[model samples]
Target chain A: MSMSPYSFRLAAQSLHREKWINLLSVLTIASGLLVISVALLVAYNVNAATGKLPEKFALTVYLNDNLGREKIDALIGALKKKQSVAQVRFIPKDEAMKELKTMLKNANYVFEGLDENPLPDSLEIRLKREAVSPEEVKKLTGDIGRMQGVAEIDYGEKFLAALHSVKSGVRTVGLSIITIIVAGIIFVCYSTVKILFYRRTEEIETFKLLGATRAFIRAPFIIEGGVIGMAGGLISLMSVYVLYYVVLTRMSSVVPLLSNILFPLDLFLLLPLSGLLLGVAGAVIAVGRLRY
Target chain B: MIQFSNVTKDYENQTALRDISFVIEKGEMAFITGPSGSGKTTLLKLIYSAEKPDRGNISVAGWDLDQLKASSIPYLRRNIGVVFQDFRLLGNRNVFDNVAMALRIRGMGEREIRTKVFETLKSVNLRHKSDSYPKGLSGGEQQRVVIARAMVADPTVLLADEPTGNLDPDTAESVMRTFKDINARGTTMLIATHNRELYRNTGRKVIRLEGGTLVGVGPG
Candidate 1:
């Protein structure tokens, strides 16, 4: 009819006799969760950093020395009228030569040999953040090329392609790894509870004889499984935090932008929350798979 | 009340019980006697709903065995008590908690649970052993704990298979006395055993079974 005294004792007895087995199972689940969470953290930070580059990087469009000042003004005016062009700075010939020399400081001697400034006047274009995709930048550059006396446009092509790949791949792989890890955690919990159930077959059979409902027999084992998972996850999460801090301290030179990307505080807050959620999910799966 | 109508049970590769039919009335004490593997335990297991009959119908406490819903099997068991030959006592819990289990499942409050558990343990003369774990007790004491648990729920129908089979003859007699007293209080009891001397002298109904078939129903 309902959960009675007999079933509770049986469930406790079942969990108690097989403590080590349950502990091992929970640890297995926690390790999988830790892998997934750490992967997510890295992916999130990389995506954020990569996402900032395109909108801020500029493209300089060169004009021929023969172009009239009035035509250059008209072309620059047309680009500024478009909502996508956030900034339009005209670089004069003398100033462009100076900027070129400063950028190539390592090879300043080569530029010093020239009698006159070989650089053309240019317009430095900065697009609105959302309008700076590689394809959109190409389209904007093509429009500028059709203008009178426009010589060339310069933005690094290989860098743009690499940035785009990093941005897209993070999202795709983040989801895939997290899914696989969570599924593995659930499987671990299910098998743990299933083994415990198998070990206590006689006890469960006795509960049935004493009139125990399915829920009555299931509640305590579920409680025990959830407790194991939560404890294991929390311990693993702590270990992961310590690892993150140690790594950040030891290897910050390898990635100068890592600190600017994701705060350690954010991971500290997320780890326990993720652990608790994983605990609940693992317990639910264990309960669902057990025969009533 | 329990009734078996042409019930047959088949395992994966063997017939455990074949074409068995019988009716046991309310408030009657009967013994199921047979040699080893003579379907004695199989019949008790059916009464406990461990498995459904492969063929025919068994009605117990107003439930049709074949028609019993998976969710409602516990309801039939609520009115019946089963004491296993192995005792099946939980080794992790002390005696008090073990006996209180029957009441706890029904959501009985702690104060009431303590009172009922104490009362049940007193009946088994195990009130002094209430704090002891099953592994710490003698075989007879552990079996008595099992008996206390079964009767703690106040089941109207009691099915004990080989309840005293594992105990010494002296201990076995005391167990029989416990059942006899329980039956005297108007509860129906069925005890399955192969001990001829134990049941032959008692003034109770005896259903003799051999080779999975009933040979005689005699009065002790």
Candidate 2:
């Protein structure tokens, strides 16, 4: 027997009959989804900010003042050959002095007494983003400092470590919040569906007596839960988008970096789809154990 | 066809049926007449598989009740229509929907359900009230709606429990005539009633019960 049409009609009728309670359930689900979505947005932006810090990270390898040009070139070639190294640029001592002078143009008086440039010729080594961890940089620097012509190696180890910690902490807290909120939404749906089932006990009894099968009896309730969840998801999607638009646009002028925060439009679309699946799951659990 | 042999049923506090046995052949229309708590309803329930027998055997339309699984009870009920004294109708639904429910449960298409529901409502003289809700109908009208719902599926056996207990004399007579018309069309019927007037000149079999025991089984 094809029960789809009949069940759909029955479900539609039920939703109309119990609009008030169903509306409340949808709003409750939407609220939970909104909280999770906002947390996701904050975590996404934080991760993005922390992720960009590695692009500018580089190690300065100062060479011996008496090293020959060929030896410096050989050291640059060797550093470039390393698996973690992305690029190596040799800055001549004279060019470094000129760059330093431009940077301190307003304080030129501090450099007037120097007889000769104190800075040594250095190779700036940019590493792969994936190799920017404090431990990896420390190992690489230790290896490079032992080279014959290498004088010193410097990379900000403490800052890199702190950035990694912040990124991981954001991820852990974001996932935990989302999990609890998703479970809360499912419980809201479960309780609503169960209450609706009990309220319609008389009608269900009549259906049972009229030879309706278990599937026939459960179809409408299941559909109701799905519809409620989907609606809640749609509402939350709109709410989160509005929040993103208002807050981000207004705050972008005050904090220009806020404009770099990704909206993740593709992933946000899963809100309603996930809501629908979770709603169906909640309804299934609610009705599965009932005496039908 | 319906047959019961030495069927016994007990509730938590009291025995509802004890060592009861009877048979109503195909196309037969019979009555079970007894006082309150005489196990008349329990007998009907047993035939419909609403309650299992404590001991003994029951076969209806060639299906053995003892061997029937719980999942198959709905199929058994599809072939047996039942009416209650309280007129168990969905008040939120109109008479058309109420009658259509039985056909819908059978997964019949909407077009066929509409045709069958209208035909059954016409049979019970309720076609004009097809759009009216149960709450708007009188007691007798509500009972006829229930009868239409029960009959729309064209079941082989029909059971009624005090179908006219809540009706006035004229309405009650009219409802009985409808039942007679259904039975005349070759459907077996077993009606449970305490009112002897419902069976007094009908010339049909009447089984009597007293305190869950079969007191007599003979023609009314």
Candidate 3:
């Protein structure tokens, strides 16, 4: 029924006529979207901050005391050839002892009575990014432990497990918060549009009398709901930008790690698109509930 | 054209129509007259598919109501026009928009809608009040706007339930004159009213119902 312009015009008029109700709906949608966006921001930063932990984990490969220089060179070459190894460095017994003395500081006196250096030569291995997960790290450590002239491989299982736990926890909490906020947004849009529908019952009755199809009767209300959602989404997105620039960036100065976090530009489109769909969904459901 | 075959309509409390059968040929005008609760309105509602008959068949403008799907009701309505007792004008809209509603529902273009609505308003002698809302118009003017809306789409059938019940004698006469002119243009018109003066000397067929049952039919 050439409903595009007519529906849009009607929706705009209705929105203006019922400014207070529409304003309340927009605010409700904005508040819900704001909470979701803030949670997204926090999740983004957490992912950025914790994203580096896996790369920092090193596998300390201790060599046998009787291993020869040639055998050690061959072992280092093999470790370097592996896809999971990012870098490797050999630590001779003397160099290891020196490092221990530096770490011990004045406690080096405890080693003074030893006839010779008891520390074994080791390879400080840094795994590639792909090996950051606990399972991958374990596999890499096990492979190295079976290598010739390697006495043991330690990749700090407890530390890797703790990192995995934290990442998953943040993700689970972020998803849960977003789910709740989305539900609330839909409910708000549904009830608001339903109330708006009731307010215009007379118009609807007249439309029916004029032989208007159901789609024709429904289009304007759906458009109104969508406008509400889009406005709310855009407003919330702007607020998020303001919070990031005014609050987050300033906080980053005090907390250096926050500097690396980014608000992906894609969300500007995504949030409004999501809002439009959610708004349309609520309107459809609400209109379908009407008897006529 | 309209036809009712053994039509029986029931409400929660009582029967609204009882085994009634009638037919009005195409391009004819008829009036339904009876007391307040005599099923005049219910008969009109049945013709428009606003309510389904409990045990009967109604066919209007060549579409059978007994087998009509709910989804097809709008299209069926598109072929007919209905005017309500209370004017049924949208208070929020101006007279021009009110008249244009039927054409708009048909998805007619704006330029054409504007032209047709203006032409119809002119026919109703309310062209000057195009921009005035229903609340600003007189009862007769509002009723004229409703008539304009009904006739704007040029439907073959028009049904009016007491189109002039709230109007003064002069205004009501004017409305009847408009209906006569419309009926002369080959559109079938069925009007339900209790105003004896309207049908007294009109020489139109009158169908009378008493307590949901047809009591008589003859020229008034």
Best by DockQ: 2
Misplaced by over 4 Å in model 2 are: A1-3, A64-78, A109-117, A142-151, A249-262
Candidate 1 - CAPRI tier? acceptable
- Candidate 1 wrongly placed segments (more than 4 Å): A1-19, A26-34, A64-83, A92-121, A143-150, A168-184, A248-264, A276-292, B10-18, B34-37, B166-173, B195-204
lDDT by residue for model 3 over B1-220, one digit each (tens)? Answer: 7999999999997999999998899999999999999999999999888898999889999999988998899899998888888778888889998888888878888999999999989999999999999998778888999899899999999999999899999999999999999999999999999988889987889999999999888999
Candidate lDDT scores, in order, read: 0.79, 0.90, 0.88
Per-residue lDDT of B64 in model 2: 97
lDDT of 2 by residue, B1-220 (tens): 9998998999987999999899999999999989999999889889888789999999998899999998888899999999976778998999999999998888888989888888889989999999999999999999999899888898999999999999999999999999999999999999999999999987899999999999999999
Interface RMSD score of each model:
2.7, 0.7, 0.9
Chain A TM-score of each candidate structure, as shown: 0.78, 0.89, 0.88
Provide the lDDT at A8 for model 3. 84
Q: Please, what are the lDDT tens digits per residue for candidate 2 over residues A1-292?
A: 2347899899899889989999999999999888888888888789777878888999999999989999998998899899999999999999999999899999999898899999999999999999998788988988998898999888888888898888889889999998998888888888988999998999998888888888898888888889999899999999999888877799889998777777877546788998898898888888887886
With a 3 Å backbone cut-off (N, CA, C), the pairs that clash in candidate 3 are none
lDDT measured at residue A31 in model 1 versus the true structure, 0 to 100: 82
Better of 2 and 3 by DockQ: 2
Per-residue lDDT for A136 in model 2?
A: 89
Q: What's model 1's interface RMSD, roughly to a tenth of an angstrom?
A: 2.7
lDDT of 1 by residue, B1-220 (tens): 8888988888898888888888888999989888998889999989879888889899888888888888888888888888888777777679997787777766678898898889888888899999999989998999899899888888989989898888999999898889988999888988999888767877778877777777777786
Ranking by TM-score: 3, 2, 1
DockQ of each: 0.46, 0.77, 0.73
